[model samples]
Target: MKKAIGKAFLAITGWKGEGAPPEHGRYVLIAAPHTSNWDFPFTLAFAWAYGVEMRWMGKHTLFEGPKGWFFRAVGGVPVIRHERRSMVQQMVDLFTEHDRLALVVPAEGTRSLVPHWKSGFYHIARGANVPVVLGYLDYSRKTGGFGGLLEPTGDMRADMDRVRAFYADKVGKFPEKFGPIRLKEELEADEIAAAKLAS
Candidate 1:
């Protein structure tokens, strides 16, 4: 039934997935091109198609009531951002408890463009000693898949360079949009720094 629903959904909307780990240890899944809310369902469907047990963090409020049961059944972990709880700490704790887990985290934190990404995903992987897999939703290709796995070495700028290179030339399906992780202020800063060094 899961495969049927996933196939039917993909036939209509389309999806392509790759690089999904097969029963791996604790890690983080970073999905990008997050330019629309549609990304959530599409990515989730793709994950289902691939038979991956993905866990996602949602606001604490979303985990209460009948709807909460649905999310929990799907492995949703309600997070209270207002509790001053460190996301990285929570993830480390969860990973310690689970031993083997794949947690989905969106670096953009939203569909809208922002100057600098939240950077929490990077921290989580580094702190938890886990691989950070790059998952993506590319509207242009009508696909969603995981990219290369990155093992962050606590070097933020250098790691981000590799990340930007991976998503370069990717396009978003939405009008006036490119890749979700592209064209940020940090990219501009990197370019300027490189130019200065070259000069």
Candidate 2:
């Protein structure tokens, strides 16, 4: 049902899916270069086309009433904005509880351009001892799908360097709206290192 729905949607929208299904049973899927509202549906459709079940965090309010069932069926996990548990921990817990799960995390955290990518996806994958899979949407070619899988090597800068390379050619719906593929954590580390060297 989902595969058919995804194929039909893509065919109607004229978007082509590139890349293959991930081989890992459990991993953190990084939804990157998110620059438009349409990314949500396209991302879901791309996942469905590949028969990948992706769970993502949605607003707690979005899960209210009858619409809640639909959202949940589509792998939307309601997250309370003020919850005490950090989202990373919440996601890690979910991973620990499930044997085979693909937690979809929009590392950009928003459609608008930001200074850096959020590091929660990296932290969650590390905490759960799972690999991080790069999921991309190249609007330039109207293509979307899995690009590659990367294990969190605990070396932030080196790991992110590899991530940077994978997305170097991927374009978003709004190219100007795509920010640098970097983590603030890494930037801070670089600052700290420079400070130490100057001293």
Q: Which candidate has the top score in lDDT?
A: 2
What are the per-residue Cα lDDT tens digits for candidate 2 across 61-151?
Answer: 9999989999999999887768898878888889889988999999999999898999999999999999999998998888888888898
Total clashes for model 1: 0
Could you tell me how far off, in angstroms, the CA of residue 24 lies in candidate 1 after the best superposition? 2.7
TM-scores vs. true structure, each candidate? 0.84, 0.94
Give the CA lDDT, 0 to 100, for residue 192 in model 2. 97
lDDT of each: 0.76, 0.91
Predicted model with the maximum TM-score: 2
Screening candidate 2 with a backbone cut-off below 3 angstroms (N, C-alpha, C), the clashing residue pairs are none
